[model samples]
Target: MRPRKLILCVEANEQVLSVRKFLLETRGYRVVGCASAAEAIEYLQGALPGSIDLLMSDLQLPQMDGNELVRRAKQLLPGLPALILSNTVTGYDRAAAADAFLPKGACTPAEILDRIRILVARKRGPKKQMPTAEMMPHEMAVAG
Candidate 1:
């Protein structure tokens, strides 16, 4: 069996963090929840390369915002996928560093889960396949 994907979830609110952790865990993801960007950063620094599959953080965080966290995280692990959540739409533009941005209250739990699934799959990249002899010339070209 494939190993469960590890996610680093950062949010200042304990309640939000707990809910997110529960949601992710029940969905078969192994989540490491943190209450602050600093805490999350510390965890990242100690983590081995490719240990964490995704980074999901709240836009509003103590000391540093989610965008900054994503930027720093990318430096530590390039190509790391990040998702930023916010209660308001005003800061969506600022979350450009993130792979995706979701409005907390506006999006339903299902939507959140769908987005997470998409991001994680994107990080895993396209699946490899052997070009079959039956494949057309154009199809083989694309597959290769």
Candidate 2:
């Protein structure tokens, strides 16, 4: 199977970006880390349909912000999963665009990786099937 492609939209922080790249690549994901929301949008414009499987972004950004990034990304790739990690805790709701919110200063690298794995697993998991009824009537013989 082809490797899953992921796009990470974050501000112009080399340390954070480096750590994220290391973590994601270690997990076998093809990462395209963008320093700003505008860069991410440019990538989306040229990206193939369904190319980006996941988007992990920092909530606070200089230009467009992670929230807007996610909204636009959803429009481009509806099934794509997103996670918003930020130091500032305002305006991040589980019900909103991001699938998960990670408090930047609070969460460790391991914790962040774990959350990413969980989200990816959920996205790739098999479709749910209805449970079979415990009781069923005997089938009538067909008059073939």
Candidate 3:
């Protein structure tokens, strides 16, 4: 059997967090819910490397913005997929390192899961061989 995907969800609103946690858990994902940016950061710092499959956060977070949190999360786990949540999707820049934005109460759980799956699949692309000592400098390649 395939391991259930682990998703780290960061949100300041307790009600929203609870709802998301319940929804995600019921859908077969292992959800790690954090109440604040600080807590999320702390979790990331001590978490086993690559244990988290995706990072999901609210755009309006207390203390640190979602974009900043996503930036820091990616720094620790390169190629980590991210999803930004908001009450209304507006003024979001795709260049901000998030794969997609899910509007609260406006989208279905299946839609949310579908987007997460797409991001995970995109991140887990075709693998490539790492350069060996005998490989020429021109032959060196990196796969995302």
Candidate 4:
């Protein structure tokens, strides 16, 4: 059986955290929810390296911005895959150390799960065959 992946979910809003935690848990990911970068760092400090497989963070954290947070999180767990969530995804610097960007409220649960699965597998284990719908145009052409 495949082991459950761990996702460190960092969001400033308590309500958002609750929803995200529920979604991640329902999808079988062991989630560690944090309200700030400081809180997440504290959790990281208390945990072993590779304990958290992915870092999921909101772009609008009140104090430290998510980009800086991603950099810091990556520093703590080198090669940790990152997913950046935002309403205005273009506002974020996509080059800011994030592996994937999700526009908040724009994806269905299935889509989100698929994305998480791909990211986690890519970061943690051997590459799995991606769903055809997720293939980039160039990738599809190459496959054909």
Q: On lDDT, who's better, 1 or 2?
A: 1
Per-model TM-score versus the true fold? 0.86, 0.77, 0.79, 0.80
For 94-139, candidate 2 gives per-residue lDDT tens digits of 3278888888888887788777766665665453311111111122
Model 4 agreement with the true structure over 37-137: per-residue lDDT tens digits: 88988887787877888889988787787787888878888878888888885846653678888788888767776777778767755445335434543
Order the candidates by lDDT, highest first — what do you get?
A: 1, 4, 3, 2
Reference-based lDDT, each prediction:
0.87, 0.71, 0.77, 0.78
Tens digit of lDDT per residue, candidate 3, span 17-83?
9998998887667999999888998999888776888899998888888888888888888778899
Mind sharing the TM-score for model 3? 0.79
Instruction: Give lDDT for model 2.
Output: 0.71
lDDT digits (tens) for residues 13-126 of candidate 1: 999999999999977789999999999999999988888989999999999999999999999988789999999789799999999999989999888977887777777766
Relative to the unseen true structure, what is the C-alpha lDDT of residue 63 in candidate 2, on a scale of 0 to 100? 74
Regarding lDDT, does 3 or 4 come out ahead?
4
Q: Which scores higher on TM-score, 1 or 4? A: 1
lDDT of 4 at 122: 76
